[model samples]
Target: MTTRMNEYKQQIITDFNSRINYDNEFRYRFAKPLIELAQLKPGQRVLDVATGTGIVAIAAAKIVGDAGYVLGVDISTGMLAQAQRKVELEKLQNIELLEADADDLNFDDNSFDVIFCSAAIAYLTDVFTSLCQWYRFLNTGGIVAFSCFAETAHTASILFREKAQIYGITVPNPNATLGNPEKCQYLLQQVGFQNIKVVTQQFGFYLNDAESAWNANANSAYGYQVFQLPPDKLAQLKTEYIAEIHASSTEQGFWHDVNSLFVFARKS
Candidate 1:
């Protein structure tokens, strides 16, 4: 990997570690469908990539029971720390947590019956290499499943971008690639995954008000980029950005539309 790839990995790790205290019930809620889609069964070996807080990993461990095993790998120690706590709290002996990069997943050929990733594929620099690694590690009939933001996911950020452009502040959308169903399919196909299927889900995050919207934004990858903008532009951005967020709110609070895509495939 290049220096840039290393930087991306570090940035992602920092961001997620910083987010350990935020409202993350969604991560736990998301585990059920992700585990189900992977078709986890009793006594099957499972691997969970980016197992933040052990949501998916712990859930898989319960399903796999004592006769099976699950390995959860992540690049962030902060996340794994929380995951370890959860594992101990549950008294689960079937799962192991390790700090490792998804960029180079070193595992034996056909080692796992199921591999799962959730809501973290976009942070990866190259989807192809990760997908190929997944293919190699999965058993011949094993399944690989993951969830990602669709191209149209982050409406608040889109609104912020339009406002920022008015002030001559242009930054990259962190989710610019492999977000839509088409791109998701293309990447998996190129990596020789079979039975490729993508499920699109439309939802929204309920921010209590405009201030809450800004708070959420400030905690995101876009917020980090926005903070680095020139002072004058950043000031202008804050004004219009807040106004846009306020305008989108209602009695039910501000609703940020979340469009997500769930990608699943099998190693043939």
Candidate 2:
């Protein structure tokens, strides 16, 4: 990996380790639909990359049954700890959680029957490099499925970037690349994947209030933009962001829609 890429990986590992470990009610929402796109069968070996808390991995293990095995890998020790605990608690003998980097995975070529990633692909600094590696690791006729935030997914980041522009600040959002169907398909095709398909899901949840909204934004990759401001400017930025969410709020609560792009590709 290039120095730049390695640096970004470390940044991602640090930022995500805290919030995603025990995401009981929130991100776990994507597990079923993301795995359904895989079309997995019994006794098939599966790999779940960046498997935060093993949501996708554990779900796959159930479908694969005892004859099959599922490996859930992540760079965060904290995340793997949570995943291991969940797997053990559920008595899922077929699922294994490992602390490993997704970009430079160390697995034999053509080993896995299915590879899945959920809401974690954007953190990969080099998309093509990693997808090519996944293609190599997947067995012939194997399937690869993953979910990424659709272009319109992160409304806070949209507001962050929008508001920042007025203050002469430019927020960088790498997640935007996989937001739409066209971009997702083009990347998969470049890596020699066929039968490429995308399913769009709109998962809108209600935040209790503006504080809840701000905390959600601070926990994800959007936090980078939140922290970019100087200490003096940060207070002002927070005030603006809180109001941004409140402005979009209704009498019940603040509403945020999470659009997920579930992409599936085949190796054959």
Candidate 3:
């Protein structure tokens, strides 16, 4: 990762944290699959890495019942605050929230029965390094599950790349950690995770109208690159992107599509 890429990613995280409220729509679209992939069991010890607003942690707490425990970790304090509030509101004593970097967890070896990461994997500067840490955290026979946006499934990202070319904005190369399932598999194998399996799925959000489409993009990773542009240019980009979405939408509504891959592996 070059300095340029790191800067770009920081800007993205900052913008996304600011704009995207944890709504029911987001939980249904992103958290549902992650929960399913986690295959949680009662009395299991689960670690929710990059836990964001704590949706998956909360879900895991329920699935694991009173005997189980869920630990949620995130780098962003704001996101963790929201997660803690949810914990308090739900009176969930089993879930613990912490502010920690995913790549370098401060825990003893083989501490967790299962570890789960969601869309935050794409933002990792070195996903392989983080995956290695996760591998170390799992007890023997324990599994690690995560969901990431597959590069193949991100139509908006591709569209943004094309648009960046047309507009002469010097957007950096796509993050190496993004939506490529084959590469992800190889990285997992390299980290000594066995019985690896990867599955791809598509989720589409049909915006109520063009305005809703604009709002979603503005709050998402795809739009972060163009977010800091001058107001007029930003407006122009939004308008053009909205038009592109409207033109490509299905009968349901304007479609914002992303490809997410579920990966599961074990420390042998």
Candidate 4:
């Protein structure tokens, strides 16, 4: 990647980690599902791919306890640094965080007992290739779980694109393929995973009053324009974006129409 692209990616990670607070509500509502999918057990070595902010890794460490170990890997140095700091603050020696790309993981085959990827899957350059590589890293019967927004899931992507249009910035593909839950199942099976399961879920949040919801969409990878926008226009974008949401708010606040898929499979 060019330096500019690398910088942009790093900025997005920094912005996301900076703006969003992963509180109990977020954990129970979102992270918990991914953690449950991890199926972590004591004394099991696990890896968290694209572990932004180390939330899943931290949760896994608690589940695996001291007997097992959890390692989180991400591509952004800044993000990894923040995750490492959080791990240290928690004094979790059982968990390790590293800077690495999901597309090219550096580990031996059959090394991990469980592998999990959270919302980060969409950012991967090749989702299937990464799935195959991660599958190779899992032990026989090892489980791999990944979650992504379903294509039909509607939330802020539309708002983001509309805002981008106002800014004259052409954003690259969001990298998130929300299109086909079945495709996720097929990829796992093709990669030699058996007992494949694909589940879809809907979680509604009051976007009218939630700051995290707004920031998660505006500052995350979904909001590419936020990263590319010049400093002068950032405040404008933020203002207009928030206004856009409030403008549509009703008595219950704006409802976020989010649909996600959780795919689980085990290496044969």
Candidate 5:
């Protein structure tokens, strides 16, 4: 990996590891839907990429029964440790958790019958290349399923970038590449995936206050660039971000759009 990419990966590892405990409930809520869409079956070999805490992996393990196997890989040791605990608690012999980068995985061609990545593909350094790799990892007619956020999702993030631009800072949107159904389908098509499907679901909710929303955005991977600002500048940015939240708030509270896109395709 290039120095920049290595640094980026390290940042991602640090960020996610810190979130291992607090984010599981939220992560599982979204992952449940993706797992249902996967339609896992008995005796199938599965790969769960970036499988934080193995929510999808464990669920797959249960549904696939004793004969099936799952290999869940992630870069965060802390997250994998938690996943291991869960697997052992359930005595699931069919699932294996590994500390590995999703972008650099090595496996023989046609190694898996189904591949899953829930709410994590957008974080890959090269999403298109990663999809191509997954295509190669799957058996012919095998399915690859994953999820991402819509470009217009996360209202706080959208407003944060808009306000940050006025301060001469340009924050990157990680979800930009796989942000929409069309983008998701186009990339899978380019990678030779057939029967591509993109399902949209709204997991959006109202945050009771600006502080709650600010805290979430400030701590997220998407907010890493903004978080790196100097103390003075970051304080000013936070002030402006809170003001934007207030301006956009409704009687119900600030509506944070968690519009998620669950994408599936076959390696035909």
Candidate 6:
């Protein structure tokens, strides 16, 4: 990997490691839909890329039964440790957790019957190339499924980026590459996947107050870009972001749109 790419991966590892103690209920919910889209069968080999906490992997193991196997790979040892503990507690002998980068995985061609990546594809340095790698690892007619957010989703992050631009600082949108259903379809098609399908679902909610929204955005991976700023500038950005949130708030509260897209395709 290039020096910049290596640094990016390190950043991701650090970010996730720090989140080991945080509640993963959101990720668990996000991964469940991908499991349904995968439609895994008994005895089918499965791969879960960036399988943080092994939520999807463990679920897949249950559905696939004892005859099948699951390999959940992640870059964060801290996350993997949590996953391992869960697997052990469940007594799931069919699942294996590995500490590895999703982009650098190596396996024989047609090694898996199903592949899943739940809400973690955006962290990839090269989304298309990674999808193509998954395509090569799947058996003919095998399915690959993943979930991502729409560009318009996460109003807080969107507004933060907009406000940051006024300060001459550019914040990258993680969902820019595969934000919509159409973009997801085109990507799978280009990777030689057939029987493609993209499902859109709104999991939007209202934050109780502007402070809640600000805290959510500031503590997330999206906030990494602004961390390098001077403390005064960062504080100013947070203040401006909170003001924008208040301006946009409704009677219910600040709306945070979790517009999710579940994309599935077959390697044919």
Best-fitting candidate, scored by TM-score: 5
RMSD of 6: 1.8
- Looking at model 6, which ten-residue stretch has the lowest summed lDDT? 215-224
- Each candidate structure's TM-score, on Cα atoms with residue i matched to residue i, is 0.90, 0.91, 0.84, 0.80, 0.94, 0.93
Off by over 4 Å in 1: 1-7, 22-24, 167-169
User: How does model 4 fare in lDDT?
Assistant: 0.75
Q: List the candidate numbers ranked by lDDT, top first.
A: 5, 6, 2, 1, 3, 4
Whichever of 5 and 6 has more TM-score, that candidate is 5
What are the lDDT scores of the predictions, listed in order? 0.79, 0.81, 0.76, 0.75, 0.87, 0.87
Model 6, clash count?
A: 0
Model 6 lDDT at residue 200? 90
Q: Which 10 residues in a row give candidate 4 its minimum summed lDDT?
A: 170-179
Q: Give the distance in Å from residue 224's predicted Cα in candidate 4 to where it truly belongs.
A: 3.4
Q: Write the per-residue lDDT of candidate 5 for residues 1-268, one digit (tens) a residue.
A: 6875766787788777887454546777999888888899999999999998888999999999899999999999989988999999999999999989898998999999999998888888889889888989999999999999998998878888887777777767878999999999899999999999999999998877887677666666666567557899989988988987888888998898999999889998
Write one digit per residue (lDDT tens) for candidate 4, span 166-244.
Answer: 8887545443454566777667777788888777788756665545555666666556456567888976877777787
Q: Which window of 10 residues has the lowest lDDT sum in candidate 1? A: 216-225
Sort all candidates by TM-score, best to worst: 5, 6, 2, 1, 3, 4
RMSD of 3: 3.0
User: Which scores better on lDDT, 2 or 6?
Assistant: 6
Off by over 4 Å in 5: 23-25
Please list the Cα RMSD from the true structure of every candidate, rounded to 1 decimal place.
2.2, 2.2, 3.0, 3.5, 1.6, 1.8
What lDDT is obtained when candidate 1 is compared to the true structure? Answer: 0.79
